[model samples]
Target: MNTPVSALMPVGWGILLGLLAQSASAGFIDNSSATLTARNFYLDRDYKGESPYPAAREWAQGFILKASSGFTEGTVGFGLDATGLLGLKLDSSPDRTATQLLSYNPVTREARDEYSELGITFKAKVSKSKLSIGTQFPSLPVITASPARLLPQSFRGAYLISDEWDGVTIHVGRMDRVNLRDSTDYGPIGLASPNGRFRPGATSERFDFYGGEYRPATNLTLRLLRAELDDIYTQDFLGVLHLAPMGEGTFKSDIRVFNSREDGRAKAGSIDNLNVGGMFSYRWGAHSLGVGHMRQFGDSAFPYIAGGEPAVLSDGTMSADFVNPGERTWAVRYDYDFAGVGIPGLTGMMRYLHGDSIDLPALGGRDLKESSKDFELAYVIQSGPAKDLVFRVREAFYRNQQDAGSTFRSDNETRINIDYTLKIW
Candidate 1:
């Protein structure tokens, strides 16, 4: 007979709680929930002769445990949240692999076997305000977890969120380390430190941020955000979100603008970047349409996640990573709900993205262009024994053009996800 970790978790937690009660002012186990999920994906790429890398095919499996509970009653309400994650490499080959679940060693051309992490957050609330210290999963314009792959990325930091004022909410935080979606180790972000090269190090620490959202009206929300990345840059953002009724359904719109500039040591020289984007969606019955455009200005690329040490580049240029000095992107999408067809919990969406005028340094010049088109189809089971089960399929075709070289490639991915939740309180 084998005892599963899930079965023994409550006993272990009970013992730990007893030990903490001996030292802590007050403690309690109020709520517990467990979830299990898995993902299957496939990818393929075809490059021109002597391309920098070969084609890839891979699949991944992941398990995540999130447990949270409220602390003993006191002057200030206290709580603790803990998360555990496990990732396994189910399938991969030298020619086809991804860094979503495991980091690939370029030299060895092999993926790591398994990766895991444990994160905890301690929080206190007082008079409509809350403060937390510990690792957190953040989703903001400046600092957001990248869930583009199988597992989502995480950050180690302290944060505070407050809603003391009517119609307004405020957020602020400081982060020092980032655990990417693919790796278990926590590393520093490029903007967080200035180590000459773009590599994760321990010497860098980013300054905290201040931001807020105001919703004076029921249908509109306005946001303002500002942050300073020590020795890297400073960024400010403004956004507006609106929701209104249209026909038999509703209309939604989102507009965002960002102004980024270099500060302090200014490692990446002087930063002068501005991004503007707007998305609009209209729904009539079971069908919806969405369109958006995003543009990047200045001589630098819009920085997001660094993708870790063995970074995955969008271009095929070795020794030269592609972030593009200036880029313009446009997107269009459509969605349909089966509920309108008398079937509930069934929805589908298809989207396409195109980009042009990319800035590349190694193409003998700075005039290069790249574009990609992706199609996706997904369905979720609404009821019955397999309720909440999901199936998805996606395909992407990418093309790059420039005076020096041109190449084309395509990739396909599929995933089957199933999740169930149990509440024990």
Candidate 2:
């Protein structure tokens, strides 16, 4: 039986008030803030293969409300945070369903008219450390939430972060359940997605991680972290980043690597993967150029929670991450800021990625190849009544030669997004 929070609040309200009476400092209500965001989204995907599925085209609108309260002043402080999300379907069909923008009935294959969810988290701070218990959106080298779609995924658990030391920060967390971006219910954590992945249907009750970042200098940062999905897999990561200033621009070098294997009972079976990737970029005033590479160098594919971004990978796109076993990917990218041309809030990006030598016995052995070409343009209102409004579009053309072993089909996709935010404080 699920009990309402109101019924339990009274049990602790007195103690909360008693603590507030300490009165060393009081910023709770004074530092509270709230914001509401409105998003209009449209996605179109078509297949260019001999597959039996139809094209997926969908349009939807979403609203997200986030509220946070400041801590009660003292040697130790407490606060509360909440997030609410609502997605309304405007266009969809039985054949065009499964776009991930809306939930559909399994039997009917019809998308729902709408879906919504709300979550709450309690937080406390002591000195330079903070503890949060409940809903969370974590972004770390090992794992992170994805907001690339209509809504972002959220987790339920506890996390502690500390920066008490001068040059290092620490993080430890345990997440037991997650609400997928397209679903309204929380479920066990798993390592797979609707496409391009591994260990489908394998799930665990807990996902845990610890470790942090160290900044030895103003221009360099290093990270060492560990994560595990209980009874499934264990993963360790090493990351280094450095920025150097050149004549009129700056050059950035980033490297990330992950070594993973089976853990505990190994429910996902003989899991073994060494995921490695990096990116080097140079920026000069209005233009930036970059090259990236990511590879899966183990017996199996890289593991990550379903519906989450493979943030550690340098060349993951809407279609593929080039994360299959023994696969290697290389990418080139270019970005331009229209502000240099008198359009202050406009920007554009173009990138291409290719992967080969994929080893998947389920399809074929090695020598498989997949490639993606992507283009994006975005603009934000800089002033007037709509200062924060944003407009963006993304396009991708993906093809696979080892085809079935990688991306299921050669395809094209286009996405358009318009967003606005309003402060409710």
Candidate 3:
């Protein structure tokens, strides 16, 4: 029998009170907010040497509803937050399958139509510290949430945050379950041991973590973090971020280092990594130009999500921190605001990324190179009958260098999206 939504109402109400306490000091209830978005995506890939899957195309639509409120009057304030998501298929087939929002069930080998989840958090505050429990989406150095898909990924657990120190903020938490991007069910995040062996049946009911950030100056910040993926691995991270004005815009630099070692019965190996990257941006009128470089060290790839490991030298997000394993990447990007050009609510972006010195041991340990370029243009109706409506177009081209007699091919893709957001508070 399917669980009824009513069964979850009691837990939802409890979480509302906790969240309100955290937002109480700010004053004023948020009232309520909701936004509906739809996307049409088309993706294609042609691999020269491998046949992972055939070229594919797909169209999908999604909707998101978010509601939040302020806490009740008192030293210990209380509030609630909730989100609803839906995704529908516009076009797809077995031969042209895309995993954008739908995944094939392993048992039945059928595509699922939709995925959804509900999250609520309860919060209480004292002085400058706040405590929360229940389901929440947290984005930290060690435990970042994924919102790139239909619904934002969430975790089931509790957390606490404090900002009492002059220039320091501290966070501590424990997470038990995670809802993946393609599935509504929550599962435990598994960790691999250092010795290249799998620790079977070693599951963590919850993972514990603690971290702090301190800013000694106006343009500099230092961070330290520690997390224990119960029975999997214990890791520590240190990072420094600095920002300085250069001409009209700013120059930002980031340096991060991580040390990971096996814990419990998996303490046979270890990973040490260091990442260094910097970006320089200049804005004149409505146009902005940016250039960045990032490099990685150590044998293992940089860690991001709790259980989902990233590929070495893979640029996971636009953050530029995903560069992995004996790799060096450089990117140049430009953004223009049409509003400054008298066309308000219009903007465009273009970027090119080139990577070299990729060490792929599986491909006979040969050094490889790859490059990709992406372009995006978007416009939003600012006012009038169609206010808040948006339209966007994007395209990308990817190419990989190949040796003589190699049978590799390049890939290209184009996508157009139009969305209208209606506020129903």
Candidate 4:
């Protein structure tokens, strides 16, 4: 169950007091900001494998209204933040219902046409540190949300962030429930592992995490984090980002490492995994080239929060995480910026990834492989009356030897997105 209203009354009272204080001071109202965002999304996927059903296609429109008030003036400042989300299914049917763009009814096996949710946060600030209770969207290395669909996923919990040191940042949080991108209910956290992506047979009511980021230099950053899923698992993450000058261009590298194992009680049953990878890139003028390699070790695959962004090392594509037990993946990608050719607000990218040496114990310990290719084009209105309007198209092709056993079968997937944001001060 979610935190009850009785438990949240103190937070509500704090918000009311903050509002009174804001009226006493002009800074709160003067510095406040609000925005309304509209998003249109379309998805189509064609499956290929045994018992291949018809294609799954869906269309959706969403609206997000976000508002934030400035903190009241004092040694300890207080503020409030709110978000409203509404999603409408434009096109969907029972046969084409697994698109993840709309909520599904478990009993009727029907997709809902509409869903809505509201989130509120009461925040307090002391010096450079801030604390917030209620719904939050945290994009940390170890715990991150997903925004790839019509409405972004969100976590309901408490978060603390501190930047008291010049080049150091600290984060600590506890999440008790999650609202999936398409679902309208709060649910317990679960691990998304290879054996069970959706029904892991394990759930946790508490997820605690702490981390710090250090920037020792202008172009160098280091991060370390630890997370625990009550009795399910414990995970540690380390990441580094560095940039250097190379000839007329710039070279950059992003590295991430993860170590996970079953926690006390072992609700997920003896989970042990190690994941490491890095992406290196060079950018010159309008052209950029990058390559990445990732590896998974141990019997279990890398674990991450269900229905959220993947926590693997490699950059994600439309159809694959490239993360299987004993699997190694390599990816090559190229990007171009039209601005360098005098066409601002336009960009294009292409990527190809191959995964091999996958060990699937369920299939008699068979070794298999997979590969995928993806392409994307995006543009935004730069200076016209419809400025800030953005449009994007993405297409992907994936093939796997174990297509029938994978979470998503070998297929071709396409997505189209349109977004516009209006700022209301």
Q: Using TM-score as the measure, which candidate wins?
A: 4
Candidate 4 per-residue C-alpha lDDT over 1-425 given as tens digits, one digit per residue, 9 for 90 to 100: 24432375488677767677576666577778999999999999988766345688899999999999888888988888899999998998777777778997756657788999999888888999998888789898678888888899898888889999999999988898889899878899878765343236688888989989999999999999999988988999999999999999999999999998888888877777899999999999999999989998887777888887665655458887877778899989999999998999999999999998987755435578889999999999999799989999999998888745657578899999999999987
Scanning candidate 2 in windows of ten residues, the lowest lDDT window is: 1-10
- How high is the lDDT of residue 421 in model 3? 65
lDDT accuracy of residue 57 in candidate 3: 57
> What C-alpha lDDT does candidate 4 achieve relative to the native structure?
0.84
lDDT of 2 by residue, 335-375 (tens): 99999999999999999988888776556556777889999
Candidates 2 and 4, the one with greater TM-score: 4
Per-residue accuracy of model 3 over 1-425 as CA lDDT, tens digit each: 12222344465566554454445445426543555555444444433344444455556677767666555456665555566667676666676564455554655545567656666666556677877666667776667666655446677776788999989999888887777766677777654221122333456655778999999998999989888776566778777778888776776666555666556654323434455555566776788887877676666534344333332223332212324356677878889999886999999999888877765454334467767788888999999998878887777676655432222334565666767767676
lDDT of 1 by residue, 111-190 (tens): 87777788876666677887666667877766766655656787767678999999999998887777878778887755
TM-score of candidate 3 against the unseen true structure:
0.79
Model 2 stretches astray by more than 4 angstroms: 1-25, 193-199, 402-408
TM-score of each: 0.82, 0.93, 0.79, 0.95
Clashing pairs in 2: none
Give the count of colliding residue pairs in each prediction: 4, 0, 12, 0
Pick out the ten consecutive residues of candidate 3 with the lowest summed lDDT.
Answer: 311-320
lDDT agreement with native, every candidate: 0.62, 0.82, 0.62, 0.84
Clashing pairs in 4: none
TM-score of 4: 0.95
Better of 2 and 3 by lDDT: 2
